[model samples]
Target: MKLFGSYTSPFVRHCRIALLEGQAQGTLECEFIETDIVSSGKLSPTKKVPFLTDTLYDEKNKAEEVELTDSASILMYIREQSGLTFFSSANDYNLFCNVNTVLDAAVNLFFLELKDNILPTEGSYLERHSERVLSALQYFNQQEYPTQAPFSDGELRLACFLDWGLFRKRINIDGLDNLQALLKAARSYDIFAQTAPPEGA
Candidate 1:
């Protein structure tokens, strides 16, 4: 199996963390192909990083290749391939999706500002997304964080998103105490460090 993404993608980071944490590293024979948005455009319909491809053999020994176009789908494929579950409970899965929601909003806003020189203009779609980002952060501040190693998917995803948002200067997550604590704990682990984006990103 192969995973393609950039060094700085939070979505990709979560998948990496899940593989390491689940001890699926050697089992999957996984290869990570570093890619950027421009390159991804030709490889995926979404033109996004973190797509995956794998070769499989059917009962008839027919070889087939498959492509997963998004991180969430890739994650589920990883889980199935690894025989591991990232979510400990339904609530955890819900939390993971919520983090995706806010992170997506922030990323969209960041790109709008970057490529279009647009801000969250009053009553606009971007404006509503801005509100969603702020509201999600405020509520997530009070969430129950993962306390130790082998953190759940939601916990790892949240930490990656927070760090990315900070790195991109897209949002300030300071004062989100619970989330901050989770990030601090995750940072102590070598897997997290190993998956970190390169310096100056």
Candidate 2:
């Protein structure tokens, strides 16, 4: 199997964390290809990183290639194959989707400022993205988790976004107690530390 993406991308980071966990569990073997936007764009129809490919064998022992075009799909495939479904309930799934939205808003705003040279102004898409990011963070802050709750996929994904947002200087997570706690807890894991983007990258 091959997982193609950049180290700094929150979307790809979450997938890397999961895939690395799978490897530790003896459930998966994959090549994580560190890639860039210009190169990965040519590899996928969507012109994006975090694309994945795997070989599947049937009862007849026939080989076939399976392509997953997005992070969610790739994560799902890994979880299914590994029997490590990190989502335990409807709420977990909802949180996963919500975190995905915040990641989208945060990354878009990051690039719009750093790469696109389009600063956020009142009522612009950039401004709206900022609004979406803060609203989602506040919503996550208002939620509660049980003591020592399992650091599952939803929380893991959220941690990726929080770390990336901070690293990129994209968003302020002030007063978001729940999110702060989760990110802190997730960072304690060896896998989280291992998959983090290269220092000074």
Best TM-score among the predictions, by candidate number: 2
Off by over 4 Å in 1: 22-26
Model 2: residues with Cα > 4 Å off, grouped in runs? 146-149
Clashing pairs in 1: none
Each prediction's TM-score versus the true structure:
0.91, 0.93
Task: Tell me the deviation in Å of residue 150 in model 2.
Answer: 3.8
Model 1, span 46-114: residue lDDT tens: 898789999999999999998998888988888877888756799888888999998989888888888
Q: After superposition, how far is residue 137 of candidate 1 from its true place, in Å?
A: 0.7
Query: What lDDT tens digits, residue by residue, belong to model 2 across residues 1-201?
Result: 999999899889888887887787785889988888898778889888799999999999999999998999988988888778757899889999999987887777667778877776734777888888888888988876533435778887888888898888887877878877777777777888887878898
Worst 10 residues of 2 by lDDT: 143-152
Candidate with the greatest lDDT versus the true structure: 1
Task: Supply candidate 2's per-residue lDDT for 15.
Answer: 89
User: How high is the lDDT of residue 105 in model 2?
Assistant: 76
